[model samples]
Each structure stands twice: as C-alpha cells, then as structure tokens.
Target: MSIRIWGRPTSARTQKVLLALAELGLPFELTLASGTMGAHGHVAKGNEAFGVVDTPDYRAMNPNGTVPTILDDGFVLWESNAILQYLAMKYDPDRFYGSDIGRFASAARWIMWENNELIPPMHNLVKHTIRLPEDQRDPEIAAASRAALGRAWGIVDTQLSRTRHIASDSWSYGDIPMTIRVHRWALLAGVDALSPTLARYYAEVSARPSFDAIRDPAMHLAG
Candidate 1:
C-alpha cells in the first residue's frame, strides 16, 4: 500500500495520525504540509503554514485547507479523527479500531467528545497562553478556558474511577485523542494537577514510544 500524509508534525491533530501509524508499524511518506516545512517560501497571515493551507494544490484535496490530510494509495482522507479511525480499521482491525460493533462505537463516541467537548477549551487555553503574544493574551479568557478544561477532565477522571481505560478495559483508538489533549493541557503554565486516576491514565498513555517520537517541542506554533 502507498500512503502519503501531508501536515506539519507540530499540529496535535497531525501528531494524532503519526502516533497511530507508529502503533500500527506502518511505513508511509510524509510531506510537511502546514508548518514551517510546508510553507512554500511565502508567508501569509503572519504564518507561513497557514499560507500553505490556502494554496490551490492543498485546497484541491481538502477544501477545509487543514493540516493532516492523508493520501492512502489514491484515496484521500481528512479530519484527523477520521484518519485515525480509518488507519486503525485498515491496519489493526482487531486491535485499535476494535473487532466488534460495541467497541467500535465506543471509540467513535470518545473521538466525537474530544472534538466537541474537549478541544474548544483546550484550543482557547493554548491560544491565549502560548499562541498569542503577551500584549494580546487575555488572562481572563485563559483562566476561563483553563477552568472549563478542568471540568471536562473532571468527567474523564470520574469515568476512570469505573474503568481502567476510557472506552474499555484495554487501550483502544478512543484513548488517542483524549490522551493527546490531556498531555497538551498539562504543558500549560499554571495548570492544575490532574485528578489521581486521570493523572495515572495520562502517564501511562502518553508514555507510548509512538507519542514520544512525533511530539517535538520545537514544532510548536506561536500563532
């Protein structure tokens, strides 16, 4: 199979796919598509990567012009969570993607929750704290975002009290997105400690070598 993925390694969404590939032990080509490496020698919107996203070639594949678009053989896929599910199903069906309907749906449910409930506040906190300049950063907004994220994680902590994993007794695709977000939240300054169960889960999941390989600190975007 021929697989080529385009996206900057720094993007958490892009990193999600990379971690899955590593877990699946799949070999694929990677072209920097939305970060410094993907900026086709032009800077736009104060972010060269964003410039790449607006390019005609990139837009042709993903109208959203977002990072983490995958070209698997001749098939094209976008949306990071979708990419993760597809890759898992194709490469490790009985494992990451799940072997039955119940497990598969559970994975999908958490992926959806990550996108809908968790990501917004996480993105806001990152934007106000690290992405924005000091003069532009709003403490109130950051604090509110952080508080919202804390509450979201609190729910996860409660869930962990009942099960060892997010969706099942064992690790599955459902853990990937939330693990990434939890780790991202932990990186922010002044963030509170995770609840014990949640903290233990984060420590275990984030320790996967697949995550360590693609999580480059230098890849962080300042925008």
Candidate 2:
C-alpha cells in the first residue's frame, strides 16, 4: 500500500482520514499506534503514543507523536485535516474536493472551524461523559460543553438549513470532518441537543447509502 496511517480506528481524526481514503477508493494500511500506547483506553486513544509513535523511528516520521500521521508513498504528512486535503487534491479532487477557489476556501474554512471551534468543546464533553471512568467524569465540563456546542452547532445548522452541505448545495469535502464530529456529538449530546434542522441533517447524512464509506460500527460512541 502507498499510504500507511499510524493511528487507531476509533480516533475521530483518524476516522476522518480513513473515510476520505475509503471515499477515494485508495488502498492503505493502518499501523495501530495509539490505543496500547496510552489512549485513556491507554489518555489519547491521538497524542499518547508509547507503543508505536514513541519509537525513535516513528518520532522521525512524526515529531509530535500524534496519531493519524500519514506516510503517503514517501510524502510524510501530519495533522488530519491537512492529510484530508492532500488526499482529496491528489486522487479525487473534483469528486470529493474541488479546484474552484471559492469551494477550496470554503472547505478550508469549515475544516478549520471544526478543528478550532466545534471539536474543542465536543471532545471535552466526550472525555468527561464517556471516555473517562465514572469516577473521573466531570459534570461541570460536560454541562459547559453542551452549552458551548449549542452555539457552535447553531451556526452549522443555519447553514445546512440553507443548503444540503457545508461548502455547496451538494456534498463536499468540507462536510466530511463535520459529519464525523457531528455523529460523535449527537451520540453524546443527544439528538435533542441539536436544533430540529441539525438533527434532521444528521439523520439524513448518516442514512445516505454512501455513508458506508465513513461508517465504523465500533465508533467510540457506539462502543
């Protein structure tokens, strides 16, 4: 395989890359490097890399020791969203991503919004609510995340009400990360936590026959 991803399947970020690879029909290998390393299931489940990523060799490839690092046929890339762009641009640009400047910019915008805004609170909620042991769970953080998520998801919900997808009237690469994140969010936050529109949107997106590419039954929430 030309592409090898060093990460766990249950990782949200890694799943995004995996979905992209699946959508593109790209053959690859997964070098599990996080779970046994220290994922709270050892702390990361992304950053805790003892077994695989901590090795000097893995560090040489990914200095940060973060999961989801990709060695794509000799071109090394870290950061999941960046990897998504690389794959889309290289293999199926027009199909998943596009060369059009506006769409490109929009895709970049949504991906950044997901990483910078939505994910922080969403992951916090997940950590406190599910991933952490009952004794370790923090109700305060989970409540705060729920409140913050309302505002963040409101923006996306409004946009989705206006169109079928994030970057365009049709599905775009921009929707991939958001979809993955939203699936997790809904699982933890409950569909009622979302606006009627966003809830409906999630249902529709997940129900799509094409969603199989991104679907993982062992998804953290489902497990």
Candidate 3:
C-alpha cells in the first residue's frame, strides 16, 4: 500500500520527511495536521481552522497526534528522523541506509548526533529569533544559540573536509535531516553562517532533485 503522512506542510520536520520520501523514490499522500507550530491545515493566510490532531479521531490512530505521522501498510510511525530511517531501510536499504554493519552504524551515528547535539541549539535559535512574536523575541537567546550552533557544526565542517557526505563519499539517509536543517540555518542565520566546507556540502545536497520537496513557497524560513 502507498504510504500516507499526516503533517502540516509548513513544518520543517514534515518537509524533511517529504524530502526523504522523494529521495527513496516512493509515492505517498500528505494530510495537513496542525500542532503548536501553527494553526491546523493552514496552508495559507486566513485558512486556520480546527486541526485534525485536535480531534479524537486522529488521536485514536496516533496518540501524540504529531506532524508527519506515517501509515505504511499497517505500521504506524512518527518522528521525522525515525521515519527517514524506516523508509530508507525498508525501501532502499543498500544505498540510502547501507547494508554493511559499519556503514549502517555510521549513518546512524551522525543522525543521532544531529538530534542530540545540533538540533537543540538550532531550535533555540529559531525559537528566539523567528518563532516567537517580535515582542517576545530574545536577542540574547538568539545570539547565544547561533553561536552554539556554529560551534557544534564545526565538527560537521571538519568531517566534511575529509568526505563528500556525512556518512560517506556519497549521499546517505543520514544526510537528509542535516540537509533540511542546514537549509533552515541558511534561511534563519544567513548564507554566510556556513563555513566554506559546509557551504559546499549544502550546495551539493540541495542540488539533488529530491530536495525540491522542501521548496514550497508558503513554507516559513525557520520551519
């Protein structure tokens, strides 16, 4: 059965999963689900309404009612990074996920590192600088978060200095999350935020046709 994803298109994580699906060459359906990020099914201005996630019916399928929940055949899954690994392993394991033990571990490592080390600051930066209303925005938090993000991503820059992609010389599923987040960085912090190595890496990743999945004009820069 074709996969179905429930998530608001404006969500960065949702767009990340969409990019992964496109990269896997799989066809899927998308439903607009709302969350703390924005109004439900609000694909454009003045379209906000009660969201699917706010209903008991959606909660019955996935208790969290989170964005980018996927029903693949009978299996249900959420969390964009988890969804990325699932689709890669199930549909395109060798190339996207890597069949070798070391290779698989390598892809997983960077994905985890991205989640644990890089994402906190990136989210903080966005929350302080972009997500909150101007009156509620905190320049101090944004500045500190941006600085922390740059320091953390320095490891990525060093790694990229030696390899073409995060896990290997070629693109891997591990690169998908980072690719999406890097775009967010560029949009929020400015293109100059990237080191030379990171700039090249971003260029290569975005050049891929699958990256088009995250290119919707209505999407927010911080998302």
- Candidate 3 per-residue lDDT over residues 1-223, each given as its tens digit: 7899888666777887888888878888888777564553232333454378878977877788777788998898888778878888888888785676676778889988988888888877766665566677789988888788878888999999998999888778889878877887777767897899999998999899998888654464533
lDDT of 3: 0.78
- List runs of model 1 lying over 4 Å from the truth: 35-47, 189-192, 219-223
Model 1 — TM-score against the truth?
Answer: 0.88
Report the C-alpha lDDT of model 1 over 1-223, residue by residue, as the tens digit.
Answer: 7589888766778888888888887888887776433343223234445446778888999998778899997899999999988988888978795587787888899889888888888777767766655677799998998788878888888878887788887788888887777676666542357777877887788788777755554544334
Instruction: Tell me model 2's lDDT, rounded to 2 decimals.
Output: 0.78
User: Would you give me the overall lDDT of model 1?
Assistant: 0.76
lDDT of model 1 at residue 27?
88
| True lDDT of residue 172, candidate 1 | 88
> Taking the tens digit of each residue's C-alpha lDDT, what string does model 2 give over 169-215?
76778888988877777666566776787887788778865567656
Worst 10 residues of 2 by lDDT: 37-46
Each candidate's root-mean-square deviation in Å?
3.0, 3.0, 2.8
Tell me which residue pairs clash in candidate 3.
Answer: none
The lDDT of each candidate is 0.76, 0.78, 0.78
